[model samples]
Target chain A: MDLLAGIFTDYTLRNVALGAALLGLVGGVLGSFATLRRQSLLGDVLAHAALPGICLAFLLTGTKAPLILLLGAGLAGWLASLLMLAILRSTRLPEDSTLGVILSGFFGFGIGLLTFIQHSGDSDQAGLDKFIFGQAATVVGEDVLTMAVLGGVALLLVGLLYKEFKLLTFDPAFASSLGLPVRGLGTLLTSLTVIAVMIGLQTVGVVLMAAMLIAPAAAARQWTNRLSTMVWLSAAFGVLSGVLGAVISATRENLPTGPLVVLTASLITLFSLLLAPERGLVWDWRRTRNNRRRIRLERLLLDAHVLYNHAELTPESLAQRRRAAPARAKEELEELAARGWVTGRGERWELTEQGHAEAHRLEQAMRVLPKALNPRAEGGAGGAA
Target chain B: MSSDFVIVLTAIFVSTASALLGSFLVLRRMALMADAISHAVLPGIVLAFWVSGGERATAPALLGAAAAGLLTVTLVEWLTRTGRIKNDAAIGLVFPALFSLGVLAVSLYFRNVHLDLDAVLYGEIAYAPFNTLEAFGLNLGPESLWIMGGLTLVNLLFVLLFYKELKLSTFDAGLAAALGFLPAVLHYALMSLVSLTAVGAFQSVGAILIVAFLIIPPATAYLLTQRLPVMIALAVLVGAVSSVLGYVLAILLDASIAGMMATVAGLLFGLAWLFSPVGGVLTARNRRERQRREFAARLLLAHLAHHDRPVPAREVLEEFGWSPAFLAQAQQWAQREGLLAGDPNGLRLTARGAALAGERP
Candidate 1:
């Protein structure tokens, strides 16, 4: 209750929360596009690449302005994204290696620049280092306003150009054939992605920004298959986690805001992976178990019915009818009797009226009802749509 | 040895060793594993320092790093094998958590210690020379130099001894396993080696920059060569060259040697990315342009061949969206090849050019 009260009443807390919420919403929307493109690692690349840009910005301006640093970061992040894209298009190197190279290499240079700048004694205080792992306590009204404006623009761009962006992601070749400037639109999207990453730089830093860009979108994926729905859900998840992380971090003295935000997003992903109604681990496991049990019970009913028809109705025949395990069959028979699908105790099992219908359903399943009867057999692994 | 020379040589040694391991990694398409190991080794370093009670021995640190590296691989493998998340997603998941733990350790406990966050992220290569190892009351130069040198020697020997096993497993794990080579075990061994190398370089290049040493040189060598042996040798050369060049550049700019080395390495990669004759972008682009021009010239001749009379070059240029310069160039090329006879009024294909155009179908 106090945390909630702090969120509403405390001005600083409110600004931090609002900034993080905007960060999540814009980041989630843009991250959804990157995730769908299978360029999840691109976020990591941009965030790392942005470091050198921030250093360069500081070197040029000699000030600690958030907007100035972010502008530098945005451009740097854009450059890295462009370089990766260019490398991918031109070089024979695989995507993973290309991504790895650009990320580490750019980041190494960034680190070099940072250390050099610090050593040169231009600023005894390494104010830019705070952007590494962002501190929420420092975000003020101006930063919040800037974040809102930038995030709002990013979200609006995604909405306004949704069709073009969607086509570009799904089928760039087709989109180009339709006379869309696929390359230009792609560059535009890349810019928005960097902007989203830059906004989170002072909040989550670079490493965790990579996580926020994908985790929320990834979690939203488990809940829905539609891209539009995924975008909305992803945004919501991002906002919730960002605000929640900010609020929770406020209750503590020494917690870094960005990592906690990432942890929160990661927790959301974990929950979504485990608990979402559709395409979740729990849902798939429950469905698989129920289907297996249903198949087992129905098969048992058919065996008993067949044995009774053949006038082999004793417990020995019942045991004979149950091939794999007598104990499993006996237990299943008890379950069947309880459900009124079978009758006759003392190790003798007879089919009830419901049992006859259920047996017919299983028999039908053996031929033409695979889809309706068992969904697990349809999708090969993990129940992914 | 002079400290400058020692620093440069140490950088070269560490880089070459990383490049050697990185070649196999790049081939196996696990190049990003270098990045993962670099970040994941942080907690191990901290824990080793804390648990081993600040020992001077490198064993505890290496043990912690190996454990951490192996754990990262195992965790990623387990996650992937579970078929739940993607390989990239698992990587994205594991590194941050471990890295953040390291970050938290830095912020909380190690804040008061000499093991600051800067040292963890970017090692003090400049200070490496001042920290000497003494044995039997004899000065042993820089400790990082000795440690990194020893680690490099071990890496070289390991690569030499297991060359065949490493080659087989890296290229075709299935075949190697079928032959009872135990590729999985070999994989972990290689990962552990990579971990140890990262840890060794960590104090000099910090941890993340170790990835630049591991991946950049090998990737550059990959662009230049195909054979594994040549690739390894070239990677060493590349690393040594980049390290020296980076040192000189750092001296001139008065910048961090490690960062400059990484920057130089990145520059070298950019050069290879653009100019490597085998698969260089410029080479491919040149090849494409040559093909496009040749095809256009042939088509131009073919069009002329369809006309029995001399056709006005301007008319042809107008019919196609061909620039006059391109048409003139094409006409000049045909004339130079004795495939066309042209005046200012009109151009005509010679019999050879006619036959060539006719034969194209």
Candidate 2:
């Protein structure tokens, strides 16, 4: 309870939580577009590419201020994006290979710069490596303010150009036909993504920031298909993971906030993937099972109706007709009897008047459902065996 | 041997080994899969380190890392099979979570272990020489050099033995499967080799440099060559060159050798991107210009022949949507070749130009 109170009373804890929330907000908002566009790894590339910029910024300014370092990181990330685009257009290398090249090349150059700085005997390089494995504990009120401003700008731009981005994401060729500046919108969106990545760099670190951008959005995607709802839900999941993870790490002695937050988001992603209502794996499995059961019930009902005139309806005969076990047929009969579609005593059974009606309806439905479902109705001989 | 020689040799072996598989990776467009495996194998390495009680059990470590790599591939495939996410997003999701788990494990539990996070990303290749491999109380030079050299030899054999299957499946998996080659088995085999190489190289060159050596050299060679064998050969050559150059540059600059190696590899790729004779950026532009001139020349000739009269240059420009300058260039080329004899504003097709147009028209 004191840890809970610490969140509200302690300045450092409040700042860390706020910083995480800010990173979550911008990352989730922009990440929806990234996942939708199938450029999910772009965040990874931008984050890795920002390292050189951070080192260069420190080299030039001789300070480790959050705003200056982040600005430099953002510019370097932006430059990397531009270079990526140029390479994509001018070369035949596939996008994955190109992204791999930019990510590692820029990171290696940054590492070289970092080691150079370290060998140069600079004592102030201490805090700069924190950007790698982000020390959220070091986040102060000023850093929170920087995150808020940067994240706010990115969010505002997303709000203003929401429709254009939506159109661009779904159908850029159609957008071009509509006389939209598709390329300009795309570049702007990519730049916004760069901003989002930059904001998360100080909070989640370089290697794990990709999770912040991807996991929340991917988790939210399992919940909804609508763009607007996806963006909001994604942002909410991000915030939830961010705050929860920050609070947990704050209370714990040895936990790192960045990986903790990522792990939390991943758990949420796993949960959503398995248990969401429509698209979740569990739900899908249940749906398939239910569908199969329904089909079996319908087939059993039709079989009983077909055999009613020829032979006395018995569990033995029904089992033979369904190629199912006698025990299973008896169980299905009990279910149908409970539904008032069958009347039975001992081993014998007969269809009720309601059962006859349902069977007839099922027959007609089977014959016509295919025509209803298939517009072309190529093979019109639809009937139950 | 001097530490400098050991370091350079280690870099060369690691680079060559990675570049060999990197050729197939680039062709398969699974370059980032190497990145994923490199990061995801951390926990496996860590666990193996703990379970084996030391780092001396390299086999267990490699096995654990390979298993982890395969698990990563499986999880990604499972996620993509769910149809909720794409292959790329699935990849993005699975690796970081596993990597985070690995990082948290390293930081929380394995403090005394030699596996620090910095070494995970920026491997101490410069210090690799000091960790000498001793077999039967005899000094056997750097362990990294031996491990990487063995990895390079194993990759070379894998490629040579499976050359036919790899080539067929890479270019046309459908046909390879139709021919009963079982492309799926080949794919897993390739991924396993990649994982083994990644784990072997991870301790020396680090993760990002592994990506660089795996991707940039093969990618650069790809821009220069069209055949698989040539691409592989060229990639190894480029990797070797980059290692040597990167070592010298790192020494001169007093920087991270691995980082300088990747930077040098990037420089080579940049040069190849700009200057390769096959589909180089500048060559593509020149080819586009020449093709445009030839095409415009044909269109004009065909138009003149069809009309059977000299058409106004302005009319030709308007009809074909060509800019005035482009039209002038095409007309001047045609006239200089004696394919057309006309004033500045008129265009007439000569016999040879008409024959050229008729041959294609």
Candidate 3:
């Protein structure tokens, strides 16, 4: 308890929490559009692209002003995005390929520039290295305020253009037909995406910023179909992950904040992908199992119905009639009896009236299947199954 | 003049190499994979340095980079095959983790070593001239020329030898599979070549210039042509041009030659984006202008068709609120294009014009 108190009281921890919260808010809001546009990978590319810009800014100004560096980062990121767009539009290169090219190239350039700066013996370059992977612990109060203002503006813009964004994402042709300035909206969305990336770049660094943008929104999408709800839920999930990650990182002596936050975000995404109510893997498995049980029950009832038509339906005859293994048949019969779908009379199993009706309906449904399945059988019993 | 000539020659050599390789990459839709492979090979360089006890040994670095590049592709492929994660997510997860691991390794394990992360990240292209090689009787710059030349030859051979198979595989992998061509084998082979080329380029221009070379040239070429052969040739030309320009720019700025080269590639892409004939910004603007003209002509025709009696041209212009020159131009074009005819009183459609109007309505 005392250790926890001591950790919480630290200024660095407070700043880390503040920075992460701001990043979460901004990333969540921007990520919604990125996911919708299928440009989630753009965040990843842009993050790496910012490195050169940051290095270049420091080289030019010889100042460590966060604002200047961020501005430079934003410009570089935007330039990379533009280059990516150019590659996609002009060349036969695929979108993913262009994204990969710009990301690596810009990052490599940044590294080269950074190396040059280091070799040049700039004394002020000490802490700037941390920007590559990020140092959330170093975030200041002023940075938090800037994030809040930018995040608030981004959210407000999204709100104002919610309907337009929706229409544009789902049906671009329809939106263009309505004369909604599709090009302008696309540019706006791209700008917002860059801002979101830039905001998080300082807290999480370029390496994990893309994860922060994609993971929470992807997880939240699994829980809801409605756009607004998904956005809000994603924001909540992002905040929760960020706060939790900061706390966890604070608990450790040397663990960085970015990786922890990303791990938490990844965990949330995994959970949503595996365990969400409607679309999750678990739900799919359960549905398949239920469907198999229904099919099996229907099959059992049909077999029992056929047996009932046979003359002298004794236990021995019934045992012969059941085509499956005796142990399997016995288990299924027991289940049917438990469900009141079948009853034992004089050591012979017979379907109840309800079971008979269900079996008849199922047979009728199956009659459609053979015709649907075997289109060559026009009027034969093979067509009717 | 000598410096300029050398810069130009180097640019031509590098661009040619890059373009030759880029054609395969763009077609495979693995253009960005080049970038990923380039970055992921950092650990390979570091490992090579560690094994050799220094950066002097070229073989170790090449081996390490190739291994790392292949590993990245394998990891991405594995993650995607699981069906548990999206392709983009797999990429996001794999590259960063590997890159971070490399960074961490450099910082933690190699702190005491003479080499730094910057050396691995940026590369030393300015020192390329110092590493001399003897080929035949002449002394040539070490590795850069040989590596690029060899990769270019391999790329050309691969493309020529398996053109039909590559085309089939790239366009329709499923069809290629149905036809008994193993796309997986082809994919891996292409990735290996890309990895090799990327590693080679890393020494001359660093990773970023390699990316610029891979993407920018092909992109510019794509803007200029639709045919694959033409596009490939054009891309090579563009790449070569940018390399030369970049080198000159670097000399002028007294900056990193690789950085300047990448900047030049970017500039070329920018020029293509704005001014390319087919689908550039300027072309789009031109298309918009043509569309507006068509719209105005249609509106005028509709107005003339709607009238019960002959209307004067002046009244038509006033109703549409368009300039007289625009109205006159629209009328002239409509008439010349056979979408309209002039009666004694006013304009009417010819049989062809009526058919066109009727078809639209």
Candidate 4:
């Protein structure tokens, strides 16, 4: 409750939270397209590549103005993306390697410029290093307002071109066949993503900013298959992590806001991977286990029905026919008995009406849907029995 | 030794060590693993220093880095094996998280220590001459030089000894495994060396420069060569050259040495991307253009050969629906090649063109 009050009453906290929220909102919405396009690593390249641009913007403008700096960042990121795509199209280098080259190359150039600026003794560059790892605590009303305007534009464009972006992401060749401006839409999408990265630089910085664009969207992917739901959920996850991370960092003296936000987003991704309803790893394991058990129970029922038809329903005899110990057979009988599928005492047993009907149903199911009914391919043995 | 000489030597040693192992990485299409490992090794370095009671010990640091590298590979592999995420996304996810944790650890716990964040990103390559190693009361040169030199030797020996195994497993893991070579074990061994190299270079050239040294050289060599041996040798050469040039440029411009090294390496890659005769962008484009023109000439000659009499250029356009510009280019090419002899008013296939067109069917 106190934290809640601080969010509204505390000026610095308010700005940090607002800035982080804008980053998350924009990153998540555009990141959905990035992730779906299988270009998750592109975000990292673009963010790293934006550094030199930011430094150049500072050097040229001689000011730390947020809007101008981001413009520089956006332009550099845009150029880097164009170069990456061109190299990918024209060269034999793999995507990852091409991205690595641009990522480290541009970043190296940026670092060189940063060191040069420092050596020049420019007092205006006091907080420039903050852009490297980001200093969320330094965010003020102006930075937040700039982030809001840029993020709002990106979000509005994504909303307007929703259908075209979807078609482009899922099947570019098909979209091209439909006479859509496939290449234009793709370039526009990347440009919007560049805008997203630009807004995020002041909050998450370059190194961890890719996670802001990837983790939320990746987590949302586990929950839904539809692009619209995924985008909305991704944005929500991004905002939650961003706001929570900013508030926590503001509360803690040493914790940095960007990393804290990334850690929170990563935690969400890990949680979704393990616990989401349909696609979660945990649920997948459960479904497979239950399936095995169902198959076992059905096979046991069919085996018992066969033995009963042969007038040999004793535990010892049933055990011999099923190649199991008499003790194991007795255990199996008790389980069926608990379910009221069989009636048994000591050594002899008989199938109940429900058991008989179930066995017949299984027999019919196997005949009609052989593959689905018999995953283990033990149908021949069951039929012979 | 002059500090400039030591710095350049340290850069060269770091580059050589990274480029050797990075060749195999690029071949295996695991180039980004270099980036991932370099970033992920930060926490290991921090933990090593922390556990050593604030002393910088080489053994603990290397061990920690190797463990961290292995952990990164295992996590990425495990994530991919879950079938929930792709290898690239797993890498994109794991390294940043580890890196963030490392950054947070530094700010939170080691704020008062000498291991500041800036040093981690831009290691004191400029100050390498002062950080010397002493043994048996004898003064050794810069410690980073020794570290990087030793790492380069280890990588060189590893690549030499396991040349066959590395080659087999890298190109065709299935075939290598079928022959009981245990490619998986070899892969881990290679990743461990890459980790150790990154950590060793981490203190001298910083993280991002290490990535440049690892990827750019080998990638440049890849664009220029197909033979693995030639590729490895060329990568080391490029790395060495980049380091020297980058150091000189850094001195002239008064910029960060390691950053300039990376910048030079990038410049070399750009050169290779544009001009390498093997699979270069311009060369491929030229080849494609030549093929298109040659085929158009052949088609034009065949069309002329179809007629016993001279066919007017207008008749040719009406029948084949050729763009006027394209047809003119093709006709000019044919006439130059002696495959056709005609003007726009009249066109006929030469004897050479008739023979060439006869071979088409």
Writing each residue's lDDT as its tens digit, candidate 1 over B1-361 gives 6767777778888987898899898899998778888888877877787786655457787788778888888987876675666787777767776776766665556445423455556665322211232321113337777878988998899899999999999888999999999998888889989988988888656766688888888889999877899999988888899899988987787776777888898999999998888889987888887777777788788889888888997789887889998887777777888889975669888889988988945
At residue A292, candidate 1 shows an lDDT of 95
List runs of model 4 lying over 4 Å from the truth. A288-385, B113-115, B125-141, B283-361
**Cα lDDT tens digits for candidate 2, B276-306:** 9998998888888989897787677778888
lDDT of model 4, residue B144 = 80
Candidate 2 or 1, higher TM-score: 2
Write down the C-alpha DockQ for each prediction.
Answer: 0.44, 0.66, 0.18, 0.62
Q: iRMS value of model 1?
A: 1.7
* TM-score of chain B, candidates 1 onward in order: 0.85, 0.77, 0.78, 0.79
**Residue pairs whose backbone atoms clash in candidate 1:** none
**Local accuracy of candidate 3 as per-residue lDDT tens digits, A50-163:** 988898899889898888888788899988887677656755546775675577557746764665576567788877666767778788878777777777777888889989
**Higher-ranked by lDDT: 1 or 4:** 4
Residues A331-355, candidate 2: write the lDDT tens digits.
8788888879899877889999999
Error of 1 at B331 (Å): 11
- The local lDDT score (0 to 100) that residue A133 gets in candidate 1 is 70
For residue B196, what is the lDDT in candidate 2?
Answer: 88
TM-score of chain A of each: 0.85, 0.85, 0.86, 0.86
Give candidate 3 regions above 4 Å deviation: A1-7, A48-63, A75-130, A159-167, A172-184, A240-260, A267-368, A373-385, B1-18, B42-86, B113-115, B125-153, B172-175, B199-205, B274-361
TM-score of each: 0.78, 0.82, 0.68, 0.82
Model 2 CA deviation exceeding 4 Å by range = A290-385, B54-56, B112-115, B125-141, B286-361
lDDT of 4 by residue, A1-385 (tens): 7986889999999999999999999989999999889888888999999989999999998988999989999999999999999988987888888888999999998888888888888777877777788889889999999999999999999999999999999999999999999999999999999998988898989888889999999999999989999999999999999999988897778789999999999999999999998889999899999999889888888889999998778788778878999999999888888878899899779999999999999898878777676756676778878
* Location of the lowest summed lDDT over 10 successive residues in candidate 3 chain B: B129-138
